[model samples]
Target: MIPIRDTAPCYSRPLATWGLIVVCVIIFVWLQFLPFEVSNPLIARFGMVPLRYSDPSWAEHVGLPFDGYLSFLTSLFLHGNWFHLIINMWFLWIFGDNIEDRMGHLSFLAFYLLCGLIATALQWYFDPRLEIPVVGASGPIAGVLAAYFFLYPLERVVLWVPPIVVHVPAIAFLGLWVIIQLYEATTSILFEGGVAKMAWWAHLGGFIAGFLLYRLFLKKPPDGIKMEDSSSFKI
Candidate 1:
C-alpha cells in the first residue's frame, strides 16, 4: 500500500526534515546529470560497500579508502533512481514533521543520522562480504516511521490501495509495514542468500532504533500542548 498522508499534528516547523529532503534531492539531481562514467564511480565511492570495510586487502586492491564509516551517513543522501528517491522522500514528508516537532531540530537531525548509521551497520553485520553499494534514505525514513508509530498510535494514515483511498490506524499501518519488512528480510536471507537485492535489514534496524531510542531525543512539548492533537501541520 502507498501512504498518501497522516493525520498526526505538529505545532513546530519541520525545518530539519525539509532541509534533509532538499539536500537529498539536490544530490540526486546532480548525480543524474553527471556522465555515467563519472557518476557511477562517484556513487561507488560514496555509497556504503560492506566489503570495503570487511576485507581491507580487497578494498585497497580496488582503490577504496581504508575507512568507509562515512558512507554509513553519506548513503542516506544517495538514491539509485527517481522512484527510490520519491518513495523515501514521500514517507519522510508524511511522518517526519511530527517527529521533528517532538524532538526539536538538532536532535531530530542527529537521531536521523544515528538511525541511518545503525541501519547500515546492521545490514553490514548480516552480509559483511557483499560487494554491492547500498544507497538510499529508506533506512533513516524507516526510523521516522517508527517514531510516528509510537507517537501517533491513535492517529490515522491515508493510503492509496489502488481503486480508492482508505484511512488506517497508525498502529495497524506501521505494524503491517514492520511485518512486511521482516518477512522480506528473512526470505531474502534464506532464499537469495544475501542482501544484495534490497536492504530490508537496514529498514528493520532503523525501525528498531527508532522504537527503542526515540524517547532519548524527544523534547518536552510546549506548555499546555498535548502530543495527541490530531491537526497536522501542513508543509
Candidate 2:
C-alpha cells in the first residue's frame, strides 16, 4: 500500500526533518548528474559493504577501501536510483516531521544516525561475508516509522489506491509493515541460499532499535524544554 500521508498533528516546524530531506534531495541530484561509470564507483566507495568489516581483502577486491565504520552512516545518503531515492525521501517527508517535532532538532538528528548505524550493523551481522554494497534510507526510515508507531498509536495513516484513499489506524499499518518485513527476512534467509537480497534484516533491526531507543529521546513535553507553539518552522 502506498502511503499518501497521516492525519497526526505536529505543532512545531520540523526544521531538522526538512533539512534532512533537502540534503538527501541535493545529494541525489548530484549523483544523478555524475557520469555513469563514475557514479557506480562513487556509490561503491560510499555504500556499506558488509565484507569491508568481515574481510577487508575481499572488500578491496571489489574496489572498496577499508572504510572503518563510516559507510554505516554514509550509506543512508546514497540511493541506487530515482525511485529508490524518491520513495525513501517521500516516506521520510511523511513520517519524519512528527518525529523531529517531538524530539527537537539535534536529538532527532543523532537518533536518525544511530538508528541507521544499528540498521547497517544488523544487516552486516546476518551476512558478514557479502560483498554487495547496500544503499538507501529505507532502514532509517523504517526506524522513523517505528518511532511513529510507538508515539502515535492512534494516528490515522492515509493510503492512496488510485482514485480511492482509505485511513488505517497507525498501529494496524505499522504492525502490518513490520510483519511483512519479518516474513520477508525469513524467506530471504531460508530461500536465498547464500545470497543476500533486500536487507530485510536491516529494516527489522532499525524498527527494533527505534522501538527500544525512542522513549529515551522523545520530548517529555511536560518537563522537557517546551517547543514553540507554531504550525511548522518549515525551511
Candidate 3:
C-alpha cells in the first residue's frame, strides 16, 4: 500500500525534514550529472559496506575512506536511481512532518541520524559477510514512521491499494508494515543468503530503533501544537 497522507495535523513546518529531502535530492541530482565511472566509485566510497569492517581485506578492494565509518551517515543521502530516491523521499514527506511536530526540529534531526546509524549497524550485524553497499534514506525514514505509529496510532491514513484509496487506522497500516518487514527479513536471512536486493533488515532495524528512541528524544510540542490521546496508544 502507498500512503497518500495522514489525518493528523502538524502546526510547525518540518524544516529539518524538508532540508533533508532537499539535500538528498541535490546529491541525487549531482549524481545524475556524473558519468558512470565516477558515480559508481562515489557509491562505493559513501554507501555503507559491511564488508569494510567484517573483512578488512574488502577495503583494499574498494578503498572505503575514513575507515568506512562515515559511510553510515553518507549512505543516508545517497540513492541509486530516481525510483529509489522518490520512494524514500515520499515516505519521509508523508510521516516526517508529524514526527518533527512531536519532537521539535533539532531533536528530530538527531533522532533521524541516530536511527539511520542504528539501521546501518543492524544491517551490518545481519549481513557482515555480504559485500554489497547499502544506500538510501529509508533507514532514517523508517524511524520517522515508527515515531508516527506511536504518536498517532488511531489517526487515519489515506493509502492507495491499487484501484482504490482506503482510510485505515494508523495502527493497522504501520502494523501491517512491520509485519511485512519481519516476514521479509526472516525469509531473506533464511533463503536469500542473508542479503536481499533491498536492505530489509535496515528498514526493520530503523523502525525498532525509532520505537525505542522516540520517547527519549521527544520534546514539548510547539505552542499551537496539540497531541492526540496525550495519554493512551494501542499496539
Q: What are the clash counts of all predictions, listed in order?
A: 0, 2, 0
Which stretch of 10 consecutive residues in model 1 shows the poorest summed lDDT?
A: 226-235
TM-scores, each model vs. reference: 0.92, 0.91, 0.92
Q: What order do you get sorting by lDDT, best first?
A: 1, 3, 2
lDDT of 3 by residue, 40-126 (tens): 888888898888878776677667644639898999999978999999999899889988887889999999999999998999998
Model 2 TM-score is 0.91
Give candidate 1's whole-model lDDT: 0.88
lDDT of 1 at 108: 100
Residue pairs with clashing backbones, model 3 = none
Q: Candidate 2 on 194-230: residue-level lDDT in tens?
A: 5555788889989988989987787667765675422
Question: Which candidate comes out best when scored by lDDT?
Answer: 1
Error of 3 at 51 (Å): 0.5
Q: Which runs in model 2 stand beyond 4 Å of their true positions?
A: 194-197, 223-235
- Tens digits of per-residue lDDT, candidate 1, 1-235, equal 7999887767999999999999999999999999999999888888999899999899889978765388888988999999999999999999999999989999999999899999999998987887878999988888888988887886889999999999989889999999999998888878864434689999999999988899889887679976543334321
Q: What is the lDDT of candidate 3?
A: 0.88
Off by over 4 Å in 3: 65-68, 192-195, 221-235
Q: Lowest-scoring 10 consecutive residues by lDDT in candidate 3?
A: 226-235
lDDT of 3 at 73: 91
